[model samples]
Target: MTSQIHVALRPLWLCRACAAPWPCATARLNLLAEYRNSHVALSIYLAGMLYTAVEDLYRLNPQDAPKPTALHDRFLGWTAPRAPRPQPSD
Candidate 1:
């Protein structure tokens, strides 16, 4: 006797109406994982921006709100774009 394991990929809309548990099961699992990852990334980005904005507001009285230094160093290091080069004098 021989035994084998097989995996199948199915669309979520089809899987939802599937009567067989196995077919729907894997789809649900994958969908859940994808949702979790997206949620985490969204939460991190929102929190980072919110924190930075609040910090900048607190620093506004001193006229320091618009600079990049209000945000976390690590976030700034990762997301901040490079400065443009100075134009040459004619």
Candidate 2:
């Protein structure tokens, strides 16, 4: 288990812990490690957050349209593919 915790900052949706983007490098790494076998759950969780972030940020920056691809890449993308699950011993 990791000793550190990464929290998100509002409006900008940056990392409160590292002050980088929310789910910043450290947060993303930790999330990947923590949810190694639960990729789908992680994706769902991130997607939910991404939606909320979009809504909040959109209200703040109405003039600049947010790109779905870019937002996905930033908030929930960049994760490495999961490793194969361990097989049970006979």
Candidate with the greatest TM-score versus the true structure: 2
* Number of the predicted model whose lDDT against the real structure is largest: 2
lDDT of 2: 0.82
lDDT of each: 0.42, 0.82
TM-scores of all models?
Answer: 0.27, 0.76
Q: What lDDT score is found at residue 78 in candidate 2?
A: 71
Across 1-90, the per-residue lDDT of candidate 2 in tens digits comes to 756568788888888777887888888888888889998888888888899989988898988847878898987767655578999999
- Model 1 TM-score is 0.27
Residue 57 lDDT in model 1? 52
